[model samples]
Target: MTGKLGIGIITYNRKDILQTTISSIFRHTKTPFEFVVADDGSSDGTPDLLKQLNVPHVTGRNKGISWNRNRVLWYLKEEKGCDWILILEDDCFPSTFGWELPWIEALERYGHVNYMPEITIEIDNDITSGSGTAEDPFIAPMHQAFCVGYHAKALSYVGYLDVRFEKYGEEHVEHTQRFLRAGYGGLSQYLSPERGQLFYLRGGLDTLPSHSHGNPEIAQRNQAIHNSIRHEPLYRHPWRTDEQMFEFREEIATALTRPPVEPPSDPQLFNSIISLGGDGIVNRAIKDNFHWAGLGLFDQFLVPFHTLTAFLQHNFAGLLSTTCLYGYHDALRCRDTLTIYHNCLDKPAHVHASVEMFHEQLPALQYRFRSMIQEMDELCHKTQRVLFIRSWRDGLYYKGQHRPDHSATPDFRALTDAIAARYPELDFRIMFVNFGNAYVDDPRMIFANTRTPDDSTAEEELAGWKDLFSKHRITLLQNR
Candidate 1:
């Protein structure tokens, strides 16, 4: 196997730090390696500096750390024709204590090994370095900064750094795990104490200021990258347990599986703006309609309509229609008091007409309110429904008036109790988003109102409602 090494360094806007890193690499390492700098759309003068150095480099079209690293690897394989690649970040400065020699030795000895050096991170007076070695129990490091040998055969086996994991978290771990699962062994080497001294001056990777401090933009970029990776179909790992991670992965998978929409550069942020703006438009529309209906300006006729319309347009108008349906059901419950009031005033002889009238009108609502309630019951089932689902599903639907009081009526307790009794097998979790003094006197009023005189009192009332809606399984979320 050819042992030729290609030095691949990835950088963003840290031109000065990158310069020092390049200098250290050229100074301490006597090995004849072709240097490849992968520039990730740096606005700084780093590209100009690279041009002056006349080193073989590749500039990426977009800004992404993982993408830059992968670009370097592709460039080395395609253009440099190097069998092995020494990958390093822009800030890692190789030390003098046989830093270059040890990497070569480790790779030579361990043939086909992914060698990681003991990195000494310096922060003011504190220094952190690796402890274990190849002979001992190995704890994996996050960054692949040392040496990685690429065989022509293994080249086909390995995939790119998940471009979605653009920022700094679990990308390396995922990559290492993938290679390890494929039967590759990792190697580690200790740096000489003298060489470790130079590592202290290397200011980039130190935990003193933290990565977020050094580059806040990188942190934001990382979120998008990680989101993108999670969205990839092939990136799913079954062993992951975190709910947030799983949610992210599911969201990403959904995004990848669905056809691409020409989203604005920042889709999450853009979506947030659209949600807020859409809520405003829906609210204005509802308010205007209520004003024309002879309802006083302060009258709450538009509240429920606005809430339902905003939710439907914001979340379900496109891909999230099912989730939007859940919000419409919630909006109906919140405005039940208004519906009751309207029915009482409109038909004085028939006080019981409100529920039936609302049910009749539910079909004409923008979100298919009645049908959505059934769909949510089916999709979430009894086991998966929780109080958080109400907020999560509702919040996603509408970015307007987060006032829980506005959306939840005084009669919510009755409705919740009814739902709980009907679905004995399902666990419903509910959290009250106290909208503060905006709607009710106490912000905690929503929670207070939901509580019955005692657990048994609540249970008995719920049982009665359960008998009424026996055919439908409905879980009521309790406010904690």
Candidate 2:
């Protein structure tokens, strides 16, 4: 626990974002640690940029995500002897300065610190102040590997990530269950009250290969995930004190004995990413987690997000949108009533709201529909491809020769990439079906030659979607 912390980034192709991630780490993290990048054969300028930054990096020959992560662990843990390594995707960055101290401190107390949080946290100078528990800190319980810090001692027992998980998908959850089996727990039970802990960053990894949703390979990929958690051998911690060992064992027993909760089938994508532990330790730790799961991907994102924007617009007038996430669950738990002081200079100013007033204003959520326009509730459950509906030469959503690289707007990349960074298993493709004239050369967003019968009516919009679904054989679920 007293050893150095190494921030490990798994990256490919994105040069600019990687640099920003590195710069943010140096700027925001007050802790002394090694900055290492594990590159999966980036022909981009990333390797050169790393060299310029004077950071040590390992070059990979197109090995998949799982292998790269394990290799990074081997290099950092076996060769460098760091006590802990925080695995961050290349697109992630620290939202504030010295934000890692609390994370490191949490690792000291807990065996693991899983960071799949969507709500942005801002940590002030005090690293000890937190609301999470050693078992269930921040009262937020989400299972999956978005970004996580692991103690070397814990890694020794759990071993490297299962390398068979070639792309980002379920490896983290599989790895997490194994870690639990190895007698480790997340920092849910040890959050401090003194430190400010809001951090945010865009993800840097792709989720899935293009248009690979409902592909048989996904089911096969998930089998490996099942194997990782099924019966992985457990090992006693070499460094844990007797008291820690007892608590760890208790958590494992809870996980094993409790019933597992099955993820919903709507997103079909959720089935791949969410492992069902029937009311197991994870299910029981925090009740809000079920509420979270019910949020069901992107559509669920709208509610809390809209409220935050509305609050920001009304109270903190200047800021319209932010990478920062407000206390989302708190607002809901308070029955739509949220209170953030607009005039606080350094910290959150205290305030209260009436349930009636908050509800009266909450209905305005419908006006901000542009963000969700043409957006699906979920992208065909692990769909890495986007089959856009546009006219061939109509000048609607696209303009010019229809090629992906010519697409000038890979705007979908940011949307899908953000989700992919958090879920790495979801490889996405943004395809623009050229009902209009637009070029699509970017493999990430390919152009297809499909068009709707008419663009002038909602009937046409419905027909267009139906045609696309029929062509791809996709089933659309009702949006919540």
Candidate 3:
């Protein structure tokens, strides 16, 4: 008993590409549904084209992707009183013949359906299509609202997509999680073609929004939003008891069981202890973070930070910090803001903001601790993990004329002890890896303080890690 159906195609200045998309729907679509177009302030004669085509369209004041999509949903559900609606991006297209009815029938069968085109196969470049069975289609744990169909009844609980995602990205995954938390996630099946089959235009992401050419602040904002939604499940009704959180986690885990996100591994991957380096490295770099997530699991258990400034300040007695914009510099000089793994992402505005925010922390200020601490807090908030690894020689310090004594165990021990005093609650394991000669035969030598004289013996080096992790209730596992 499907009521009046509404099909919306959202566009934002991609008029050239969108023309083919609209034509394809008319060519292949057999379902009796109203075609509604929502334009997000397109300037390339898109509105005029829609008018000439006699398509019922609405104009927006350059809102954004989420706002434009929601506008279409609002009209279909609220204004037109449609029972079901399908929203397609201006770039998406049908690859196979008569692919529309199956998706429409899916809405009739279940309350909602997320149409997963065969793009994943091409993306992965896999051996086979791996186009899963109907009963066991690839159950996506994360949602990308590329193209989707929704039953109107599910809307009563799921509400509308969050408008906070003003630009591209983050909106799809968040909305999908919303449906899951609200219990409508189960009423959906994914539709995907066989491997090597693409149900889309030749070039999708390459055309719009300067794909990946974005400000670093956007990355930070996106990550922050993701953390909030993941940490706080805004279920229509909260879970009865704290115990129910486990049920939720288990349910989500079960939903994610198909198409394993992690590569094929041991069935008991979670139970096993994992480590990537020598005992000394693991000892100095592991931490058992007790912060709990919304789902009640340990927030972050192990994290490591091996950097030039961290090692000099925490392992050696050397003070480390960037030469202030208006401050004096002695023998050793370093960029106060040591940004790693970032290039054009850090816009000038954000970099300047951070520059102004830098302030004095310790009295002598051997190294900048505030920014690093903020970074650690963010990492802990995200992974429930923190860094304990300190490289004896990092890039900036290594480039200098002088190098610190690599075998200064007493100095290392004292600094590590002071760090422990500062963070008494961190169930800490630490290591200092010497990267003085990174490219030579010994790329990174593992450094251990003299708790035991024999550094060569595996038994002596890894003496207390078992007990330390045991106390913290962590089963350390090694992956790489």
Candidate 4:
């Protein structure tokens, strides 16, 4: 491929979509552009498929998306000696016009121009379209397809993509920012009114919650990756000679090391405390309500709260203890009072009301709840375990106009069983709360009811929970 324009596409797990994307690329572009498929250690037969294609591709060690793309770009520059690179996603396919003479003409008219494609989202009956341009108030469609035409001299000016952004979301924006900072301008073009269609796939958002599986090894690996990134100094001025870049990096390291600014002491106005208990309700409440104490609690509940807590403990030491304490809960609600006092200097903070879950059939919600629990656990190990719960009770009954289903109760039972089996280590010390009349007298007080069953299903659910708790040697706390 003599007159080569390197096209790099990074993919993981989604081989079917990737294959479709590549086929579309070949169909559109007969222009001599060397296709570079950067596979991020996909276990889904993608490597075999790529091998069959017989195109030049690079397989990265089971790293992340950013690293894979960076590696491919490096190969294109250093080995392939390609002039221009067009970056595309596995989910995006170009139209027939994409490879036509118009594209080349546009490039020639606007030399060294960065072109962002217009993206269309196909909903049931309607399509939403947006030109991937960053306007004043809103960000560009960062994930849409884009073309970067590299002039010979511009190659020395524009550097590689920052691999620190391992995932898909912010890397593109960061690259655009760097380009703009380097005095380069880009444009966004709507190819046609119906240029590219984004088929809404499942789990499209990167922030969707996932299960932990309680594997310490995975947790350890994640921690190691995090630590390595934190310790590794990012040298942005890569165009500088190696010695100059190293020197600049050392200066940054030194600047990062010097830090000591003490705030004026206030003896009269003591630190305030707020404790929360429940699941998503508590998590949301704590985040929305608390913002004063250095904006720490808000970030703490972001994701994997436990990991955040541990990070704070290691870095900030007695900052949390010296400040305030907020307790959030879902399972154990007994220590709501004691947990507030012991950790918060025997002074109780505001006890945010717990949430009463009425829907009993949703097992998928349990996955989100488990993720939150893991975050809390990581935070607890970091701090003095300030947020405590003695017991928690939840059950489903007819609420509003909705009727209760017998089938729905099984899902809740399964959730309780899974929780019991998974966290057996904390069984004795942690209280497993239940929303059942057999466990507590006033079911109506805990949860509002609009209708009742012929038989009390709450009693049956409580008995099942008790059996599991006993089998796991975990303490069962029932809040009256």
Q: TM per model?
A: 0.37, 0.40, 0.42, 0.35
lDDT of each: 0.41, 0.46, 0.46, 0.38
lDDT of 1 by residue, 127-182 (tens): 23433332332233333433444443344465556655544554654454444444
RMSD per candidate (Å) reads 20.8, 26.3, 24.2, 23.8
Candidate 1 stretches greater than 4 Å from native:
108-154, 186-480
TM-score (C-alpha, index-matched) for candidate 1:
0.37
Residue 269 miss distance in model 4 (angstroms)? 80
Instruction: Give the higher-TM-score candidate: 1 or 4.
Output: 1
Candidate 3, 1-480: lDDT as tens digits: 557778888888888877777887777666677777888778989978986787777664565666667767766776678887878888777655555655555566555556554555457433222233323334443344556777788777777666555466666666665655555534222242111121121111212221232266765786576666553534332123333322222222222223212212332112112132222234232332222211111111111233322543453222233354322121122234332211111235334223223333233232333444444444334432233444332232122211232322324444455544555554444434332221211212123222221112445333434343333344333321
User: What is the alpha-carbon lDDT for the whole of candidate 3?
Assistant: 0.46
Of the two candidates 2 and 4, the one with more favorable TM-score, higher being better, is: 2
**The CA-based lDDT of model 4 is what?**
0.38
Q: Once model 3 is optimally superposed onto the true structure by TM-score, how far is the C-alpha of residue 278 displaced, in angstroms?
A: 78
Candidate 4 residue lDDT tens string, 1-480: 124576767677777777777877777775677677877777989978887876556663454644666655665655567655555656655666345233333233322334433322323323243332222111223333234444323444656555544444444444544444444333333342112222111111111122222256544554454444432332343223443233222222222222212212432111221222222222222233333222123222221223223333344232223123343442112221212111112123553322222123125334443554455455444432122211221111112111122122212223333323433333212221222211222211111111111132444333433443233332212111
